[model samples]
Target: MNTRQIIIIALLIIALVIPGSSLLGEKEYPKFLEEPWDHSPITVYIDEQNTPPHYSPSYQPTVIRALQYWEKGGNGKLSYNPVFELANTSDADIYIMWVENMEEVTGAEEGVAGFCRPMIANGRYVHADIVLEVGDYKGYSWQQYGDDNMEQLVTHELGHALGLGHSNDIRDIMYPTYEQRENLNPLLVQTTYPLIVISILIAIGISGYLGVGWLRYHKRRKRLENELLKEMK
Candidate 1:
């Protein structure tokens, strides 16, 4: 064959051989994935002693709402309680100590909104710094703004405190950007239908391969037996 034709024939042979060689190879992808969390129940205690007076009205309720939403949707378990004395002892899995002043906590700066910092040594508790603007009220700010501004913002920050990363989905509550109450999106449930279908297809393919292999084995054995019998005759 000419040079061009010979190169074309070699390319076709390589393409066919590569796929068959891959089928004989033992590489496999993992079928199951582990859930992110350790599945342990987390109890959170809000430090009432150091919490600012301005945040008293919206503080506890906003935290409770956020916790409820997380517990209901996520696989991990969480519980919360307001505490007066946790100064000397660490009891809960997560201690949410609210500081009256932002300057008291290291590595915490006043963000455009609220600020949160996790205790690295303990890694279980997170301290939140609440600084109210000149005109912001404790209880009335959430009520006046509704979901338009503060409630979702606090909820989003609290989610970070609870070990949740931002979701890329705009429709999920964990989205990086915050929306107003009327515009807020609820968390969506993850579905297993796609995974189930893919698993079934894999099973079908494996079964078909085994069946074809068994049939070919029997045909080869029968041909070898007839040849031996003819030689004996």
Candidate 2:
């Protein structure tokens, strides 16, 4: 082949070798995934004394809702079905408490709503402690940020406890700064095998029907010829 034809052939081979899915840039966020908790239906303990002022008991429902949101938001590699149970901090896989100085732990100049401390071992998270610091922000509370905003913040911190890191997309719930409610896209699944199985069954049924018709036609033809020959003889 000429030089130009050889170059064209080389380009075609390279294009065929590369996977189309890799070009799409679909990747899960990091941290919790490294050492995800193996247990299912994990329980979280909420400290009654460590709640935001005017937020205890009344705002507890919102915490449950946030846990459910993160549970459904996972990519299925790690499963979370968190059940909130009231208890002392010592006996808990996860703790949801309030802290007056949010900036001290998070190192943010302002608007540090909440943060989490994950206890990791063997490349997986064993437990975590989350703190919400609504008191640190002036004029901010469940009344000011509203139920929706609190839910967003709780969901974000819980995600960290479950082994997820921050995301660059502001819309994602895992983002460092909570701007909006967001969820990760579920992993894509292939339906090709089911479709192929259905097509094969349909082809077999049609072939069986056609074979039966052909046999009946030939049998009738033979009987008619035999009668005609008897009459001619």
Candidate 3:
């Protein structure tokens, strides 16, 4: 072959070999877990003095269930203090001001379910307001109403209040769409099976690329030595 043809063939060989070699032994690679975020403990205070939908008896239990779900699902050790007595000094960081009227809730756009504003404490505190409607739960609207439905809404909103964004997984509590009021499922945990598989594939691709390059170098060196011995003989 001419010089140009030989050069072109060599480039083609490298292009095909590089990607092909990366796929070898990819199924048997080690995987790594990503570290969780470092977040401070959030305290939730129910406004005791508030009347009607705000300070109902069932409200406290629903909030507690939501907090417990976060502690287990997030794998986070979070301390929750639900207070009715108005102490001058409170340890809670996120104070939930429950409002009876839907108009009081901020960021309630035409189609949005709820609104959240980050309350900064020394430029670090994150807080928000949670509003509940008395007769709104039975209808088809997303606003929470009854005890069961209210628990579902509280679980979803508190997730946002705790610095969690909406998850795409329908099974996850953090998902934007509202299902029923259910406990956090193990399958929908942040560290899902797909992440493990992707991490393994990346590690294998890297290791195989290095291994194949070393093998090719040794094979070429041995061929060169054999050619030199034939010339000498």
Candidate 4:
């Protein structure tokens, strides 16, 4: 309404602008293939490799959890039937495997997590396999995330296998670059949490500084008015 109020509002808005503004430009919303999965609740099988330097007891469970997270996290956009836990058969719409070797694979770069290769037929994705990096790679460690990047790896590849392309959005699960996301919500892990806190702190600091100035101005104005009144008397 007034100049001081407008300044405060502008400062607060600027403080909060970083989170949403970063998502603007180029507009690659829902980057996807020509065809989506032809069926509901796509089935997935994990080819668990239980060998030294490649296997952990947590691997299988973590894979299953990633599958389940897909079913729940996407707000009904995805459904997964994890068949690997029940049987050894890798017969499913999607197959997930762990590997330490990357020399032969296409996109398994050093420090890379994994990659997805989908088989398409009749303009539809028929089958796909996700190869995940196991153990440490290029001296980099997986000390973060409860599942240790496994969940994000599977989830990202699953998005591709389901006919979705990599998202430009940093907070998206299908973001091309692999960022350390300890939380299921990528926003919190990627950009939202610390930035949001910083913005709030900035807004508070600005308000406090302005408030102090306004209080000083008010005191000075009141004292000057009393002096004027005394002079008039």
Tens-digit lDDT track of model 2 for 25-118: 2333333353357665566887776554545454456678877776565434334454444455556778887654466555645556777776
Tens digits of lDDT, candidate 3, 1-233 = 57885675556556555554454222222111121122444455665665454346786787677777776654231223322222233335555545554443533333333333445443333445554443333355544456776677777766655544455566766666543222222212322334334443443444444455545555555665564444333
**Worst ten in a row by lDDT for model 3:** 28-37
Give the C-alpha miss distance for residue 108 in model 2, angstroms. 4.8
* Per-model RMSD to reference: 20.0, 23.6, 17.1, 17.0
Name the lDDT of candidate 3. 0.47
Off by over 4 Å in 2: 1-28, 52-56, 74-90, 104-108, 135-144, 179-233
**Cα lDDT, all candidates:** 0.41, 0.56, 0.47, 0.56
> Which scores better on TM-score, 1 or 2?
2
In model 3, how large is the Cα lDDT of residue 118? 41
Off by over 4 Å in 1: 1-39, 74-91, 99-110, 119-150, 178-233
**On residues 112-187, what C-alpha lDDT tens digit does candidate 1 reach at each position?**
2343333423323323332322112344342223433555655665555554445555665556563222111111
- Highest TM-score: which candidate? 2
What is candidate 4's lDDT per residue for 78-190, written digit by digit as tens?
A: 33332223335677778877755443343444545666777766656687777766545345544333375767777787766765555666787877665222222222222
What TM-score does prediction 1 earn?
0.38
TM-score per candidate = 0.38, 0.54, 0.45, 0.53
Q: Which ten residues in a row have the lowest lDDT in candidate 4?
A: 181-190
Q: Which candidate, 1 or 3, has the higher lDDT?
A: 3
